[model samples]
Structures are given as C-alpha cells and as structure tokens.
Target: MSVFAGRYDGRCAIITGGASGLGKLVAARIVAEGGKVVLWDLNPEALAAAKDEVGATRTYALDVSDPAAVAAAAKDSADALGKVDILICSAGITGATVPVQEFPIDSWQRVIDINLNGLFYCNREVVPYLLANGYGRIVNVSSVAGKEGNPNASAYSASKAGVIGFTKSLGKELAGKGVIANALTPATFESPILEQLPQSQVDYMRSKIPMGRLGYVEESAAIIGFMASEECSFTTASTFDTSGGRTTY
Candidate 1:
C-alpha cells in the first residue's frame, strides 16, 4: 500500500535506532518500497524484534556513542549489504527535563554524547562507503527545540542544534560527489521518547505546535523517505522542517 513502491529498488540502508519509534517506522517504509535494511540499536532484544517485524536483512547491537563500535558496524554493514545507500540516524534521547542551572552534568554529557557525538561517528565511518559508491543519502534527525531552544531541555536542544550544524558541513563536503547529507527538524512528536519526559514538559512541547497536536511517526517517516531518496538530489546540506508549524524559518 505504499505510493513509493519500487522507489527503493536495489537500495540498501543502515538505520540506527531501527528498533522502534521513528526509526522502526522508516525501516518499514523502505522495506515496503523494495529496499533492504540493516538495523543498528543498543538493545539486542529490540533489534531482533525489529528485524523480524520489518524483515530487515540484518541487525547489529550497537552503541553509537562508542566510536570503535560504530566503525566496526559500518564496515560490517557494508560487507553484508555490498553497499550502503542510505543512513537514517534516529537513535536519541530527551535526557532529564530540568532547567539549565539544574541539569545534571552527567545527563547533559550523555545527551550530547549520544545525540551529537554519536551521530558524528556514524557519519564519519559511513561516508567512506557512500563515497565509494558515489551515491548516498544521510538524514540526521534534529528537533524544533534545536531551532528555538526549549526551557528545561537545554541538552537536547543544544545537541540537536549541533546535528544541524554538523550535517550542513558534511553536506557541503560531499557536494558534487553524488552523496548528500541533510537534517530533519521535527516538533514534538507522539513517540516513545516522550515517555522519558514529565507530563508537564510534554504538554509544553505540544502547546508550541500550531497544529494543536503532536506529529505522527508516519508523517515524519514520509518526509524521511523522500529525503533519503533520489528525489532529494538537489537539496543537500539543508534542514527539512517537520515541526507542525512550530518552526517556520
């Protein structure tokens, strides 16, 4: 039932955080469109379940924050898939909800490590494979919080902002090489990540969306599907907004 049927024919993708939420949803779309995918996630059990659910070609228990692990997984994925055509970085956390002054230092560091540094490692290791093929798509998930900093979510916002900046730089570097990189800035979405936040925090985010509701996973996945396809050929090094009108700039 995919309008994008056959759009991904013969393509192979590596999706971090492919175990659930947006990552899992995106994997389903790619599979429905005739692409093969290799999933990477921190939870082996979830990874296994996701692979079965989405019919992924492979799964790797990965901690993107670990540079060595990311590197090894990248090579293994390429070896297994023959080539990697797309990378969807959706694995992230909201961290503890608290004012910047009260934010736990450890929590802040953890958010930055996983949300920003981890993404950097994945991109660095995978770009070589993409460059070798001279064709690739990278979609790094950011947040509306990144564009307009949210109170009590400083770490998440800052890390996502870094994602935007990093993706911009990478897109430029890969320009004219047939490889493209972009970032996704979505407003608060109805996701498992919301469970980590207090209800008050979630409500605050929901209130910011002019659409009067949180975004659906499918809605975000649709944009990602397009961004990670040949149709996105000319729009490299840019940020695609999915903020439900919360971010118009």
Candidate 2:
C-alpha cells in the first residue's frame, strides 16, 4: 500500500456527481493519495459542502446534460487543474419508478438526458485533453440494473446500459492511445439517491443480491481509485461489477 499510495501524486481528476455518494468518496480517495480533484455537480450547495468534506481543488456547479455547459466546465476544469488525468462520470439520477406502460414520458426523457446523454457530453468534452496529453483514465458509473434490466426502472436501466455500450466504443477508439475507458456496474449502494426509489422496489433489488446487503460507497471508491490509477493498465472497454455476487459475468 505504501508503494502504491502516491500513484496519483501530481495527477488531477474530474469527478461528476462529486457532491455526494460514491463520486464524493472517490474524490476523497484521490485527494488522500495526493491527487488534485475538481468536483462537478448540479447542486451548488452540495458542491460547496463536498469541497470542504473532500478538500477538492475546485468545484463546478454545472449540468452535464447540457453539452454547452459540459464543454465550458471541461475547459474550466482543465484550466484550473492544469491537466485532468482521470474522469469519473458518476453524475446520474434514478428517475421515477413505474412500469413502462405507465411511465411518465417526461420522466423517461429526463433519465435518458441525465444518465446517458449527459455521460456522452462529459466524455466528449474531456477526451480531447486526454488525446493531447496521450494519457488518461475514464470510469463511467453504470449499474446492475442495466445488466439485468430491473422491472419498473426502464429509464434507469436503459440509460445505464447505454453507458456500458458507449464506454466500450470509446475505449476501443482510444486503444493504445495512452487512454483507457471502462464502466462499473454496481448493485444498490447506500446513497442519498436511494430515497428516490419506493421501499418495495428497493427491497426487491436487495433480495436479488446474494450478499443480502447494500454496497458501501467506500467500497466503490476503492475500486474506482484503482481504475483511475496507472496500476489499472491493460484493461479497457470492460465492465467491472461491484454487485456483490449478483452478477457473475
């Protein structure tokens, strides 16, 4: 651990949804390991709070769903941090819980906009810098729901699945370019986002997990930290599962 402790020493990272949840924990890990971090989140208040909590180098209150905003924020982050070696796209939302037939059209679109399209926007804006430097790591947060397609969560599942596909394509394109892209498919984690789901739906999800427990944000941060480090070489266009035995593939 001592030898690997400073893996990110001098590296800089951009973490979306860093205001809370796994993203924030990732930021803490990077910072703890001597990396500079720029936190991006839609909530200004949460961003401020997270800055204090994680000792982030900078914080941007920007909506990743908007391409223009994403582009601007990307530039700002690069400028502020000097260079961004890692990008963690954890900014997502779990939209309404309703069957496809009864799902609200607005809710479906919103989930797609934030979870999928927003991810694309961030990746598009950041990859350029990585290309110029010829070095980078990208970790997109997906979910087990995407792989298994949870009932009554069509929007969430579909959006996360899109992330998995998009990440694979991006990784292949960057193959041998000193950049690696991958996605993480995690089971239900203890986070504020869980409040959006109905208790019944949450229970159903937990029942499927052989571990009989929700994932901890710290556990996810640890995996993500490794993925963002130079130690994670030779892996790209892959999906790493944090599903507690729920997904064997």
Best by TM-score: 1
Q: 192 in model 2: Cα distance from truth in Å?
A: 0.7
Q: Write the per-residue lDDT of candidate 2 for residues 1-249, one digit (tens) a residue.
A: 122578789999999999999999888888888899999999999999999999999999998899999999999999999998999999999998989999999999999999999999999999999888899999999999889999999999999999999999999999999999999999998999999989999999999999999898877788888899998899999999999999868
Q: TM-score for each prediction?
A: 0.98, 0.98
lDDT of 1 by residue, 108-178 (tens): 99999999999999999999999999999999999988899999999999999999999999999999999
CA shift at 28, candidate 2, in angstroms? 0.5
> Per-residue error at 52 for model 2, in Å?
1.7
Candidate 1 residue 187 C-alpha distance from true site, Å: 0.5
**Candidate 2 residue spans exceeding 4 A from truth:** 1-4
- Model 1: weakest 10-residue lDDT segment is 1-10
Give every collision pair in model 2: none
How many backbone overlaps does candidate 1 show? 0
